[model samples]
Target: MLIDTHIHSDTRGLEDLELMAMCLDGVITLAHDPFEMKNVKVWEAHVEKLLNGEIERAKKVGLNLFVCVGMHPRAIPPEVDEALNKIRDYINHDKVVGIGEIGLEKATKEEREVFIKQLLLAEESKLPAVVHTPRRNKEEITKIILDEISTLNLKNSNIVIEHCNKETVKWALDAGFYAGLTVQPGKLTPLEAVEIIKENKDFANKILLNSDCSSNPSDVLAVPGTVLKMKIEGIGKEIIDKVSQKNALELFNLKV
Candidate 1:
């Protein structure tokens, strides 16, 4: 019942060793990046290869998947229009769930512009957006997102603030938006995450636990570890299930 909200499979139109390793390691619900490339054709080709790779990975390991095709904040403005058009079709793909991993990064002026622009694109496309909030100044980030939600009339139900920590989890939950916890080993830390989940009993419906498993191996398998911690903290299976499965389905609009 684990649905990973964020994952990147590097399909370089060739045999990807990292992807091979992920398939072997039992990763379900991978979210591939469609906006990772600078060239539109190259990005399209990469997405196609990722789709093929998902099919192969499914047959081999039963890996469920979700993918997004919008530029990350760091890699935008090269061919934004072309990239958006290319990804538009895939948004409705039978396996595709939403239009993200698409939001602001605390990188630079250029990155912020790209991120905000993509956020507008997500609004235009009427798809759920996955946002990467700054870890340190998260309250400010939350305020920015809330303002955007108001300005765009974007439903709180249509957004997920990813990699939220104890500092910012309450704000996201209070906003009636889905809050994603990125349970990395030492980054967000196991003890702090469990405490947050345990303490937020009232806002259970607004919470989702995700690995945010990236190219890094240590980041993978983080959801299971979080679940174990929740169990140890005397949290019920019902709450755990909500964090694990129900919230994801509600946020992604998934039938599963």
Candidate 2:
């Protein structure tokens, strides 16, 4: 069974959903900054879609759908406080898993403030956090992210530094946090992901493989595909199982 820990279902069409349900046991769809940063209402509506609409859509296809709510750093709205206030009400909902897709994009002051606030919220709610590391200046921004997280009282295990590359993955693991490897066109390929797993000792315990499938060019079957690659490369089944499913299930406390 496979659980894609990060995806944007709203950006994907029905065909993608059907394909996902066919291969995945479950998925954790997260909230991201919309193209237009209108207001808190936008964030509220998006959350509602994830919790209710998207959940039902996935259910219809026999896939267990989970959600994580938070404003994406790139799209932090003008009404950040109100947006967070709205998110608070949904934190304890059955479908909600954690606070995420939140982290520094440009490393601006506003982004930092919002990122820290959501981290605190996750800590307070005792939920996991999925943090985004940008494509450009990833290493530098990730350093800042780790530094900021260090100041907080949040548990490292409850944090997932996502979109991690070879370098950032080391930092995340060194910090005692989960490293999220997003398999997509521009992200790590299956072979590269397999190599990364091989290079890191006991990586299965700390790595989470995901598709991060969105409107962007991405393979929704990235996780299972990577699993195949791992097997072909002679990676042990136990290690593959942990990175592909167990770690995510435990981190998010997912029943499935």
Candidate 3:
């Protein structure tokens, strides 16, 4: 029952070779990123393609999928309201699990505005959220998220504040949102992820494991490798299952 909670299926639309290669990893369920685009029409079309196109294709390769859509802060366009309207409709799509990869990178006013609106929308629609914190100013960006989330009064479990590192993970846990750790190049490493699980034993089950895999082939092994590291280190299988399986399923209200 391995599940990749955040995977960028195709950067420039589906590539048969890449997807087929991904199937060999044998991760059962994958939540693909139907991330925001520079053009609103393209964004809408991409999501449509993901829902109607790659999803079915994924099935052929023995993979099950759902989408996560949002207007990312880093790549946000000028006419965001138009894009948001289109995204709002897709948020309810039967195959769409949540709105995510949506949060501050530069933390500009435009990005913050877009991020907060989507958070409110997630609460309104009773959908879970996948929030991304910036690389350079992680603590600051994470604090901003906490401030906004504080006002919503939504349950911590319903939202996942993703791409967390040591400094930011504590904030998310303190605020009651699920902490997301990505095991990929230059991000949190497998050993680092295990340490978080070790230190935060009580909250280990409240964390989500994701690869955040890009086009890079080695990234595909991130999640599985991390699980193996935990197993060898004597981490309890039940706790490992929480981050690897149950937590994400419960947060996104999904199963495979």
In the predicted model 2, the residue pairs found to clash are none
Pairs clashing within candidate 1: 29-64
User: What are the TM-scores, per candidate, against the unseen true structure?
Assistant: 0.80, 0.97, 0.87
Ranking of all candidate structures by their TM-score, best first? 2, 3, 1
Query: Each model's C-alpha lDDT?
Result: 0.65, 0.89, 0.73
Ranking by lDDT: 2, 3, 1
Write candidate 2's Cα lDDT for 48-82 as tens digits. Answer: 88888888888887778899999898777789888
CA error at residue 186 for candidate 1, angstroms: 4.7
Give residue 166's lDDT in candidate 2 (0 to 100). 89
Task: Show where candidate 2 strays beyond 4 Å.
Answer: none
Q: What is the RMSD of candidate 3?
A: 3.3
| CA error at residue 115 for candidate 3, angstroms | 0.8
